[model samples]
Target: MKVLMIDDNELDLLISRKLISKQVTSLEFTEFTDASQALFYLQELQENEFDIILLDLNMPDMNGWDFLDEYQKLDAHKANVYILTSSLDTRDKLRSREYEVVKGYFDKPLKSNYIAEIINSQQVY
Candidate 1:
């Protein structure tokens, strides 16, 4: 499956990718440091191009909230989006509920098992 990861922090991005990779084989990962660029990338792609999108909440160019706002407006595929941020605040988790399409909120570093569940479940369905 294809996974699109959007995060400004290089280390966070690398760690996420590494963890995610361990869970699934043949994972097509597309990462972007800039959320705006990632948004544009999403706009350009066709529906069902990617199966999952792991987004970071705190970004310089465009925050995850703003990305979600703009993302809803664009004619894009309904990919399973998850908020993967470092923020441990419960408020951040609550705020994620505002987005209808968001699958779940996970505080990084994301575990291999968590990602494996998603990958395995998708295969089952």
Candidate 2:
């Protein structure tokens, strides 16, 4: 599986990569600590290049919402977007439903079982 992770925190990125490696041995991970850089990369990519996007909500320049807005414009089919953040706001969860690409929300310090479930459940197209 090819996964893209966008998080500003270096340590969090490190932990996530390690967790994913442990849970899903075959995963090919590409991580970005800057939302803008990630967005740019996504913008220039061909269709359906990424299986999933693990996006951080609270970023420095372009927050998760902004990234999602731009990402939605790409119009890629079956590309799952999961909110990977520490946010506990009810409104955030409610607002996430407004977007079709967003698969689900997962709290940061991500659990391996949850990651495994998502990876296993992915319907390859």
Candidate 3:
């Protein structure tokens, strides 16, 4: 599984990486602090380059909503995007459904059980 995690906070970014590493051992991991750079890479990369995208909702450079907006313009649509947010608002959850590529919405500090759930749900290997 090739996963790309985009978050602005350094602590959250590190914690996510650590949690993911503990849960999923055999996979490619890429971390992006800048949403625009991640979007650029996603657009330019080959089809199916990333299996999953764990995106943060509130970012300084570019918010997760904007990331999804730009992502829709790209041709690469294989990856399943899961919004990893700290926001508990119901509106955010409802709004995510508007995007075709978004597969799921998860709360921040993505748990090991959620990681397992993601693995089981995807079954992409």
RMSD of each candidate relative to the true structure = 1.7, 1.5, 1.6
- Greater lDDT among 2 and 3 belongs to 3
- Summarize candidate 1's per-residue lDDT along 11-92 as a digit string, tens digits: 9889888877776668999999999999888887776588888999999879999999988887766777888898878898
Better of 1 and 2 by lDDT: 2
Give the per-residue lDDT of model 3 (tens digit) for 1-125: 88998998879878888888887788788989999999888777777588889999999878999998998888665688888999989999999999988988989888988888788878954
What does candidate 2's lDDT look like per residue over 1-125, in tens digits? 78999999999999988988887788888999998898888777776688888989999999999988888877555478888889989899888889998888888789987787678667643
lDDT for 92 (candidate 1): 87
- Candidate 1 ranges with C-alpha deviation above 4 Å: 121-125
Q: Provide the overall lDDT of each model, using Cα atoms, as 2-decimal numbers.
A: 0.83, 0.85, 0.87
